[model samples]
Target: MTTAPLASNSSPASVAEMEQSLEQLKVANYYLRVALDQVTDGVVIVESEPSDPKCGPKVLFSNAAAAMLAGADPETGLRGLGLNDLVAGDKDATTLQASLQQAVQNGGCHECECALQSLRTQAPIPCKWRVRAVFNSLRKLLNFTILISPAQPNAPAKADPKPAVEDLDAQSVQLRKENLAALAQGIAHDVNNLLGPVTVRLSALIQQVQEHPALAHELQAVFAGLKRAKQFTSQVVTASKAVPRKHEPTDLSALMRDTVEFAGAGSNVHVCVRQDDNLRLALADPVKLSQVLQNLVMNGIQAMPRGGYMDVEAHNHMVGGTGDGRLKPGPHVLLVVRDRGCGIARENLGRLFRESFTTKADGNGIGLTTCKRFIDEMGGEIRVTSTPNVGTEFRVYLPAAEGSGSTKPLSPADAAPVPLKHGKGKVLIVDDEDDLRKVANMILTRCGYEVVQCDNGQDAVKIYQSLFRTGTPPDVVLMDLTLRGGMNGTETAAEILHLDPEARIVCTSGSVTQEVQMVFLERGFVGVLPKPYEAGELTQTVHRVATMMKRN
Candidate 1:
């Protein structure tokens, strides 16, 4: 006897188990909703034949926000709608139906925005609609499911979930957007910090070439490598996208001064900033904010490659323009960085904020884009005005403290350089770069110190041991943080300290993460000697280490 397909259902046992997993499914649902709202582009979800109402997408679960775009209230349910019915371009509903059938047959459903619209059209659409296929985990179409999104999906801003779960689906997407925004900001900060020292070293190398024209050809090659490195750094600055971070009340003017000084090294460019000592503070992360300032300052330096003055200014301003015919004057602080150098043309100004858009021959163009992202995350805004040859200025607006005073006095200045004479003492140089090791060796030897060079940590350790055994141990060791093959600078330093508790080992590298630098300090390294060291910086460092050694 032929039996009618008993209305097709997932068996009772499977249904019961799915019912048991509702809690887990609900959590997953929240995340999907979040992605729907927070992503840059759009997302459309269509669910049909849901076995469990709590765990699966229901016709009623379709977000009203989506329908609102189509000029319909989602509170009223939609029924008997097929994928082809939603769009006018579906000339042959058979093709769409066949694809849907295949999706169900495959045990997974899938379709992209293009493939779903490849079918024949039966009617002219009164409404312009963009059709995209919604897919299941296994690349199958959940039969009878239809989701209609505008040309682009616009995720809504998220609201707090704790106070109200009913409003969660409405705002789950917005919170996701915020999270991604913060991530982008962090990435930008890290990338800029990494590039800072490389730029500084390039500057120092150029000065060296100018000082001694005898080594011009050799130094030219080195400069070429450094130039490539700079280009590599610029690319990193380009692709870096970061999410904004949580902002707290901070002294914007003071922070800008500190950031610029630290990154500028006050050597390549003249940095200046001014503000009211008692002006209101801004809510921003000091580290991230510093990274922002550093990137801007770096850009300013590049614009004025011959070296020129750059100014950073910050102050408080009142903002008004609240709806409901009411004016709400709020405390907002403005920070400006201006450089009198080769400026951007009017045409380039409009496209400056776009990703990978740059005017410099070596620029990757991510700096301004990252800056804009960060500013937006902090609940602020950034603007720029530039002339072709005169100069360029960047202005950032940040929310300020409603009721406030000021932070403490200025931070201490950089320590004065200690004077030293070329002395006849044993100096050990450890580095991963062979060229650097040889160059350092030559510099130290010229300065009248007996020098021993090691290209890696293991080699340095072996040489140090051989010397100790031979009773001719070096007086001081310059340890590089990152080394080629075997132990790193820190490990080598630790081994040397094992032999002599008062080993005068100076940790060296052009750039190190602040956290990694701190590790050296905690582990008792005498001092840090950052890389791209000038011939003089190396001499001074050795003299200081020797003096400290004798005293200890």
Candidate 2:
């Protein structure tokens, strides 16, 4: 060792070898950095002084994922931060410190679930932290390595083993539900388009048959059937809608009476309704609540094959002491529907609200489920009690409208219906369905409007622009939302608005979802009209929008 002293300067070959080694090390370091960055788990190295454990640890290094987890710029990294800075609260920091101390003492790895706060977002994120203590050759604590991963919210500490088949089945069921919802949405649109022509043609026929009383009566009956079909289509459309219901102060007593009368019509079942004298209004979506009650009443009517009586009663209830656990403490409108019919079996009671769980031979199995869904969305609860061969009772609890009192019920004269008015103006109808376009044309023409029809959004836009340039822009534009082989209604409406900000465009769609309606309105549409609408609705909507345009 003494004879072989280090050379002050190396030869050319030796220098080249040294440079090659250095380059290889640099290459290895680059690969290591790349590998660390590729890891999904957050990796961080924190240095701590073994002599002063109370001083806590300082972050020495963090990979890209770790930096992201801390809500710091990933490219810059979170190297100069302290361990306590990343914790959510004082308690979290204390817990983390204890875990680090334990790992240091045991010279082993430790793990704990923590709620860490991101510096940028300042939001507490649940994470599973795996910490290992590092020691120097002298057995002195040096630093700690941490691996952090996002923890499943409220997951069990010890996960139980699940069969692979069970997981696959659950996934399959979820996928099937999603697919069915999408299919239902598409079918509802197509059905509404198909029904539009039928409804318009029926209206035309009814007008023609007015002179012949017998034919008029027959056509009226056919029209009633079509109305019922329209109701069914509305339910299908609502099933796929996930938006929040637009709640309003609704008269529960009036709604119950109307539903009972409508559901028990033509059936042998008789419906009786009793309303509380001082009943308060309920905060509910009138249309959805009406649908729920109608479904329940119809189910009650169907339960009784022979002649039977159904009683519907409504009252205001105060829920606080000894109240329902499912609902919060508040005043609620309680509606009870009691039917003397063949009651539900004990086994079927548990699954009455489950989708596709029906005992009827011809039942589509979605009626009760849809009803339950609507009730839930409206922040209400529905419960059923039944006794075999005796009867069944359904109780619905809806939150009462805030600040509502025992006010007098609205009279027929309170809100007079606006009579359908005939208007003289150019109207444009856009729809991919030929039948729908023809139906709209017929309705608009009958309303004394100069009707222009196009089968796609592109043609409609072109026609609108051409008319606009000629200073003969349509008074109203009815744009169908979903289109085939061209720009959709939203896109077309945007273009039309750009060309003429004063354009009065009404969005037409078979999807009667709040989200769809709101989106169109946000995109500058003046109004929204659901498909398969009556001639009166079509006339009224156009007249209303045209009037608005004139006033503006």
Candidate 3:
């Protein structure tokens, strides 16, 4: 009787404890639901039917975040929905389905891009979500869940307020371009000035080389080499450096053919150009056009690693005519480069022409931008169209010859052909830099001309006066504009002109701007040469100017 009473009394106490444990469990479930609804990240729960490996997938539940992602109400969401509604159908859906199935079979899943790739591709990819598997104690898959949080794209790329380094880099690039352009022009100008007197003396010396035939032949070869070097410099100035050149008549087909050839050098891919002979003609700086074509074709070839075809075509065009090309009424030449390779992405097309934007891993990002600058300078335009896995096409339009690019004279053809110091004439080189003046003196002496040097305008004037006192002024005077003592090239030229009205003065300076070059020309200087000149250029300009003086 005592043992039975003890058992009966223990039953009610144990039952009360069990009821309290159930209430605690109920309270925990309620809090979990509250946390789910308030969470920032989307929470998706997809369970496997019958906990079987081969069972079809089913949505067990979804949190507020998940419903928001699916374009459903956050508060009263997950009533009924299909995964297909969220994931783009076809390939994307298949990939998602397979991933869900795998996660359920494995009892748990880990974060993977394939988990959210469907949403990333379709939705603007505002956030990146990672999927994980929830499993029971028996190691059986219960549900596959994913957490979604705002991704990098949603962070606003331009919102980095403290991007001092990037801002500096961008500024540096812009400054570099401006500095390069200015420096290049300055160098060209200075080169011309240095060569002015040297070229004049060389021409006169070449006339005297009639004495030693063998020596003259050797000197002629030197002159030829000098000429070639000048051409090379011209190419460099036009290519890497920014300087304007007189445009000349150019055949579009010929330009395209040469560009294709240039890009093909040492490359495995064969470049084929199909340009219409009847295509629009234009007055273009052949050198600049050459640079543009080469850059584009090279880019096309680089896009294809396995070697694909690059079709370059040219045709006459005018605005208002449809792209299909039955030309209606505009004035342009159409050059098209069609490539079969990995095409540019839709998102990337706008950035293609932006300076410093590069798709290539190793690219410096100047090729396309340079092309754009060249085309814009030529009064033309460019357009691009690309399809992923299909191909890319770049179309360039240049104004017709009659409309914009008309051929100019070939005065620059005789750019650097004369030998300095060889011509039989009196030459004067005036500059502030003694080393440069001596260099000019040596070059002119070797060319067989008597060369005198002056460091300033006052000295230059005295020399001319003394020469005139002896009844024979120099055949040519290479004058530096800024003599560093308030006496500029302009004033010096004026003083020399007063001494010898027929003075052949080639004013020189690299620092002289375009306006100053014009000033010197207007001041009656026979030629305007710049400093930083090559030996051949010096000799050539000297000869050309002296010959003109003699003719006059």
By TM-score, rank the candidates, best first.
Answer: 2, 3, 1
Task: Residues 405-505, candidate 1: write the lDDT tens digits.
Answer: 57556643211112224767798888757666777777678778999887877678778888877877888888877564445576677887787676678
Off by over 4 Å in 2: 1-174, 198-241, 325-327, 344-379, 406-418, 494-503, 521-524, 547-552
Write down the RMSD of candidate 3 (Cα, Å). 31.5
Per-residue lDDT for 66-146 in model 2, tens only? 765665543336776777778888788888888887887777688888876766443467688999998889888778999
For candidate 3, write residues 1-552 as lDDT tens digits. Answer: 355443555688788987788667756755776678688677766654534333334455677556544444222345334444454445545666666666666655644332222221233223444667677888776666767654432232566745655554554554344335434544554465454455444444555675998876555445443343344345544433333566666777655654575566667666777755456576577667777777888887888888868888877666875643332356777889888878999999999889899978998899899888877877677789999877799998776777443323323223333333346788998888666787778876876778888887767888999998887888889987656543456678888898788888997765443433675677888887654566666777777776674723
What is residue 335's positional error in candidate 1, in angstroms?
3.9
lDDT of 1 at 213: 64
- Candidate number with the higher lDDT (2 or 3): 2
- What would the TM-scores of all predictions be? 0.40, 0.59, 0.48
lDDT of each: 0.59, 0.77, 0.64
Q: List the residue pairs that clash in candidate 2.
A: none
Better structure of 1 and 2 per TM-score: 2
Ranking by lDDT: 2, 3, 1
- Candidate 1 weakest lDDT stretch, 10 residues: 118-127
How close to the true structure is residue 396 of candidate 1, measured as C-alpha lDDT?
82
